[model samples]
Target: MPTLQIREAIREAMREEMVRDDKVFLMGEEVGHYQGAYKCSQGLLEQFGEKRVVDTPITETGFAGVGIGAAMCGLRPIIEFMTFNFSAVAFDQILNNAAKIHHMTGGQFSVPIVFRGPNAAAHMLGSTHSQAFDSFYAHIPGLKVVSVATPYDAKGLLKSAIRDPNPVIFFESELMYSVRGEVPEEEYLIPIGEADIKRPGDDVTLLCWGQSVPTALAAAELAQEHSDLSAEVIDLRTLRPLDTEAIIASVKKTNRVVIAEHGWPYGGVGAELVDRIQRLAFDWLDAPVARVCYDDIPFAYAENLEHLSIPQPEDVHAALRQVAYRD
Candidate 1:
């Protein structure tokens, strides 16, 4: 095993997949000559050259449409949005073509393409650039949504997403790019629908993925240190197939749950999970499910206000205590 940052792990995954299959190519703004907007594609241009490592104009709709068309023609393309918030520009292509072609053609064609890049807010990027779109893509029927929290998961799950026979929405966070964790040097894959129990406890369940995963883990530590409470943390790595079984099992053990997310509370991922949890594990719950999330208002441009609006350790801790009846 080797320790690598989330960005390094992602670069390795793309590089390996490109080497393994010539049909696999990368095209996005600043990905080629400039390495990448975030430098996640560094050295790829020098190794794979301009043909495989391509640079495109700052046009999400055009490039994304091109990627979908390329996939329909049997080429695997990795389409990177500078930030997933930009994906709003290409929502038509993704929501209509990439998600419908397989079924529209009666399984005759599949979009084996991966749409990836940083998601959610970073620093004081303002409301427009700070939005998290996981719930948007995950809501679609034909897309596979993956949000990885660890470097190991980033590498393994990315490999699987690249090879998946469906359009995959791969969400990363700029904040997590530099976070390092142990990843195996050997090639391996994690199944698309599996959830990993990042931390185990019997007092309550903290459900989360992607940018909110670290918050869940940190909240668990706070629960222990301050309240003498234990919290089970489950990372729902893939949102579409959503490992509800894992969530239910943890809910049964803990009899309480707190759903954390980087998005707003209304119609967010947390809301969806709460619906499922209530439908499946309602009888097991000791307290009503609670959510720790961003305030419903638009993200603020000021750093201090944005910090308060976004869910933090104390917010999750409060949710934990609320669910556990320790508040």
Candidate 2:
């Protein structure tokens, strides 16, 4: 095993996939010459050439449509939006066209495409770029949504998404790109729709994904110092076709749960998890499922306010305490 930054793991996955499959090509704004807005695609143009690593105009809608069309014509296109906030501009192509084509055609056609970029609030980036939209995409029926937290999962899941026969939305948190983790040198693919129980516990279950996974783990570490409470943490690698079995099982064992996410409480991914758990494992639960999410208000540009808006370790700790104790 070797330690790799999240960004480096992503770059390696793309490079390995491109080398393994000729149909796998990358196209997006600044992907070629700019080496990706976040430099995740650095040196790809020189290795893959300009045709395979395309640099498109600033229009997200136009290039997204182009990527969809390319996929239909038998190419695996990885489209990178500079930021996921720009994905709204291309929503029609993603939601209607790419998501529907396979089912609409009755499995006659498949869209083997990946739309990836940094998602959620990062530092002082304003309200426009701060909102996390994994919930929005997860709402759609046809797209497979994934938000990866660790370098190992990031590399494995990205490779899996690229090879899957349907369109996938891969969200990487901007803040996690520099974080380092151990990644094996040999190739590996983590299957979609699987949940990883990062830490097993007996007192409460913390269901989370992406960046929030780390936050929950940190909170669990702090909680252990003062109390005998054990928090089971589940990292949902895939959002759609969510690993409900794993979540329900964890809830049944722990008898309490707290769902953590970076999005707002209403209509957020955490809400759906809580709903499913209530439906499937309500009798097993000892307390009402709790949620730790961002404040409903828009993300503030001020650093302190921004930190306040999103769920932090302390917030998760508080939610766990509330859920694990009864009156």
- The weakest ten consecutive residues by lDDT in model 1 span 318-327
- The reply for model 2, stretches above 4 Å from the true place, is none
- Give the alpha carbon lDDT tens digit for every residue of 167-281 in model 2: 9999998999999999999999999899999988889999889889899999888677666678988999899889988888888888899888989888999888888988999
Off by over 4 Å in 1: none
Residue 140 error for model 1, in Å?
0.5
- Tens-digit per-residue lDDT, 258-326, candidate 1: 998998888998889999999998888889999988899888999999999999988999999988787
Give the Å shift of residue 285 in candidate 2.
Answer: 0.6
Every candidate's lDDT:
0.93, 0.91
Rate residue 226 of model 2 by lDDT. Answer: 60
Q: What overall lDDT, based on C-alpha atoms, would model 1 receive against the true structure?
A: 0.93
Provide backbone clash counts, one per model: 0, 0
